[model samples]
Structure formats: C-alpha cells, structure tokens
Target: MMYKADHKDSFPEKPGLAGLKVLADQNYLSDPAVFRNPADAKTTLAGELKALAPNNVSYVYFGALPDVPVAPAKMPLAFERPDLRLNGNLCVLFGDGHVESLTVPVEVDDCEELVSYLHTQKKYSEKELKALSERAHLLDGELGL
Candidate 1:
C-alpha cells in the first residue's frame, strides 16, 4: 500500500521482525491467503527475526492492508473500488539488542537486499553473514524468492 503519515506528531517506533514468533499466531501466519498476493509477499516475520538473532537488525511495519494485489494480474478489472485496509508493525532484534521499525514498503526490500548483499561485504562478520543467509532462506520459504 502507498505510505501515508497518519500521526505525524509521533515518530513511529521502529521494531525488528526478529523474535516476533507471535506473528505466527496472528491471523497473518494462519491465513494462507494473506501470502497469496505478490504485492502481499514477504519473508515470514518470524523467519526474518530468526535470521537476525546474531546481529543488530530491527524492523517494524505500520499501516493499513496493502491495496496492491500480490500480482498485478490478480487485480480486478474494476478501477474505482475502495482500497483495502491493513494496519500493523514489525520489530527486529539484533545481536546488539538494538531494535528498528520498517516503516516503508521499499524499506523492507532494501533490508532484504542488504542482508543478501552482506554475503559479499568484505570482512563482514561471519555471524551476520550466516544470519543473512538464513533470512534469505526464510524469504524463499515465504515469498518463493
């Protein structure tokens, strides 16, 4: 969904996806349909959290449900329907105990890309590299990426 600032007065708290096993219990993990859309695609919040167990990584998600379908092809022909509503946040816990919130959609992609790129970073910590690989595997499981 397109990002919009609803409560501009408060800086949204950044939380990491790591260590958030509760998501599996939230309707998100149980509802098979949630991940069916391409635009709805994402690495399981649990998986991302698990991968960051050894590093300083955090994430948060906030907003209404994304209006974009997982795949554009799945969008309806009707062009004037009201958008769906989705609201939530994700938090990540890094090895350093630092937490951050992922407030934007593209931020998620950038985070994943950073994790993937970590594999090639010179002198990157072995712990961080392993976490990134694990996170990549988790994404593959959830998004088939």
Candidate 2:
C-alpha cells in the first residue's frame, strides 16, 4: 500500500494496488535506487530522486531479536499499553525511513518453530532471494556500476 503525507488525513479509498497498473508500470518495484544507502551518497541526488518519484521508493528496516534462539518468558510490550497483543517476529519497514521496530511473539520453546515458519515464508525463499539478487545485478548493469 502506498502512503503519502498529503493523504495521511484520509484512509485510502482502495486497499492495495488494484486499479493503479499504469502508475505501477511507470514506477519500478525493487529498484536499486530505493536501496542505495542514503548515508554513503556525498550529494543530495538520492533525496532529489526520492522527491521526484516518492511512490517508487521503499526503505526496509529489519529489526533483530536480541537473543534469537531464546524467546523471553514474557514478550516485551510494544508500548506502555498492557492490553495490546503483540505478534511474532516481523521484518517490517515503512515507505519512509522514519520508524523501525521488532515485535516477536512466541515462547522460548517455540523459537525453533517460529524460525522454521519464517524460513518457509516466500520472502525468504531461495527463488525470491535469487530474483532480488538478479534484479540488483541488473540495476548495477544499467548504472554501469
């Protein structure tokens, strides 16, 4: 789903990308430009490009659990709220680089199970990983990097 500052006041009229084919076509998914480390760039080109085509950009933030193999007896609350239920380990990032947090839900005994479940997820699958690597390679080729 695409989120914009101007549209923050209202929810999207549609859920997900349905009738936005033309817009999607013009914008590249998994574009290396989106992944280029903003810190490494000496100039403001990255910011300029992001400003020019904000929809085509995405910044991923992978949150890591402190003790991977061992899940705590009581999971940390996302905030001060005690009634809210937090879910399992997630790799979520916002379109903007504003927020990043890890929320894992599972007992110490279930850590292996959670890991296994994550391994089966399509995003971490070998095929998808290879495709992403190839896409990055292709982008580098285009840039003559």
Candidate 3:
C-alpha cells in the first residue's frame, strides 16, 4: 500500500527476501519478526531479513515469475519454507491471493535433491546451499527438515 503509493503503484522491481526490508526501510513495515522462519530456531529478524538470511527465511518472493504473459493466479508470489524445512511442505501464495501448502513430491525430498532442483532454475550462494544442507532431514520430526 504505502510502498506502491510512492513507487508508481508497484513493489520492488525484483523483490527478493531482502525486498521485504524495502517496506521496513520506508516504515511501511516495522516488524522483521513477521518474516522470521519458525523452522529456524537460530537466527533473529535482524540476521534474517536485514542481513539477508543466507540460511533460510520464512517466505521467499518469486519475483521473477513472468508477469506479462502469465495470469496472476498462475504466478507464484511467495512461498514459505521450501528448503527442506517445515516437513517438505511449502505454503505458496500465488499472485491472485490464493495460498496453498504443497508437499514436495516424494522424489525430491532431501537438501541435495532440492538444491539440485534449484540449480536447474536459479543459482544460490554456496553459503545458502550449505545452510540448507546442514538442516537436511527427510523424516517428519523436530528440526528434521
């Protein structure tokens, strides 16, 4: 709202996780706790959004989802805990305001598999990959992926 008002009714051009801070930076959003990943009992909001959680955050913006040709409902706006976190269940929010928790198909279940899958689409920093790897666990248990 406030952000779009000032920026030609638009959010950041390529809003990533840190882009959420763009709102905070403008005082549009003040609490970084809203962005904290519940799965990660470690880092704080400052370390997560401000420092750009190389490890993992609660939600990630799919800023690159095609806009012109694709419909809003088809576009992925953001997702929660896709990095083998939260029991492989991802809460995806589409551009049309629909939210769904999708489980990663059994085939791609571990950090290595998810990392490889991401490799096909985008490049993640080695630090980020290592972080995901360190938390990799396929079972449904506490802090177990």
* lDDT winner: 3
The true-versus-predicted C-alpha distance at residue 56 of model 1, in Å, is 25
Ranked candidates, highest TM-score first: 3, 1, 2
The CA lDDT of each predicted structure is 0.29, 0.28, 0.51
Off by over 4 Å in 1: 1-92, 101-112, 117-123, 126-128
lDDT of 3 by residue, 1-145 (tens): 4565687545554545446657666777666676766566654556433565534345555443223333445444555545434666766665567876765666664344544554444454555444433333321122234
Query: What is the full ranking by lDDT, best candidate first?
Result: 3, 1, 2
> After superposition, which runs of candidate 2 have C-alpha atoms over 4 Å from their true positions?
3-41, 45-123
Residue range 1-145, candidate 2, lDDT tens digits: 2433344522222211221222233453334354333432322223433242213222211211232211221111111111111343233322232233445444411222223333343234455334333433432332232
Worst 10 residues of 3 by lDDT: 134-143
- In angstroms, give how far residue 30 of model 1 lies from its true place: 15
The C-alpha RMSD in Å for every predicted model, in order, reads 16.4, 15.1, 9.2
TM-score, predicted candidate 3 vs. hidden true structure: 0.57
Candidate 2: lDDT over CA atoms? 0.28
lDDT of 1 by residue, 70-123 (tens): 121221111100111023223332322244332333333433443443334333
Question: For each candidate, how many residue pairs have backbone atoms clashing (under 3 Å)?
Answer: 29, 1, 0
lDDT of 1: 0.29
